[model samples]
Target: MIDFKEKVSETLSLRTGAEVTIEWRINIKGVMTGWCRLREAALILPAAEAVAGLEGRLSMITAYLSDSAKQKGVREIAFHFDLDGTTLTLGIELPLEGARIPSLTPLFRNADWHEREFMELYDIQVIGHPAPRRLFLDRSIDPAAFERLIPYSTFSNGANSKALWEKVMARSGNNRKELQ
Candidate 1:
């Protein structure tokens, strides 16, 4: 099997109309893994298109806010794809507030679940999602409760309460009265 290194770069460059950079490493077991940090968040759609053109499969999507990223006022999302058994991860950076990214569900049907999970976990806006709604969370819980409401150490502590909602609303810059 051929490595997707060059093909992926060429395809992404063509689709994004920019020099797409990708780093690849092969494990001792001969499985290849690739990484590409998109220059801008808006470029993700084009990059996804490029990967789809290469017959890649969307394997996973991960959104994170590291302490450094929070300090820098940004969050990050990584899209992992399987290109003929090789792994390629594309990283995108977005603003901490009002972060929005176009939906990849149109290209990868599996993206719907992960996109919804992002909304439930981080308050990310998945624009143009075919169907957008709460997956498992209730309307009372903060959209970004994992980050804003509960401490990471006690994420599953079942701390959902009226007072917690008020605190989250205040921290989110929304009036606590809104929860009334």
Candidate 2:
């Protein structure tokens, strides 16, 4: 069997300009696990016993990231995959001004809700999604106010919401800090 983890690392390092890292982790069951990262892209390879076909393997990683977003309260997700088993999953904790959601619909049909939820909650625009219409937000509410409420309500009250909003707006220039 191919050592997919090593192949993935070598492939990404050769193809992309970004520096990449690889790590092996164990789940509660103590099984061998592997994942790789290039900049914001994350690639997860299943345990040897659980490995499957190419499409199935990629689907598993995307599903894992989706569940992770739900657990982490991430409002947006930008994910894509290339030929060499390199997958990118961008978890947006909160939306920032001018944030553009990457289009995964072209790559995976299942990415529809993941992108829609990101748009509805974080107000991040998903470029080239087939159905870009609003998903969860009430159409009646103003778009600006809708964006305000999604992240704001996580705080205790209006004051805390305003403070958080100001912080988000202020850090728009830097991608590293905007999600914080």
TM-score of each: 0.81, 0.49
lDDT of 1 by residue, 1-180 (tens): 343567788899999998988888889999989999998988999999999999999999999999999899999999999988989999999999999999999899999999998888996899999988877666656687667756533454335766566667777879856645
| Model 2: lDDT of residue 48 | 15
For candidate 1, list the clashing residue pairs, or say none.
Answer: none
**Model 1 regions lying over 4 Å from their true place:** 1-3, 151-180
Cα displacement (Å) at residue 90, model 2:
5.7
| TM-score top scorer | 1
lDDT of each: 0.86, 0.45
What local lDDT score does residue 42 receive in model 1, on the 0 to 100 scale? Answer: 89
The candidate that wins on lDDT is 1
CA displacement after TM-score superposition, residue 105 of candidate 1 (Å)? 1.1
Model 2 — which ten-residue stretch has the worst lDDT?
41-50
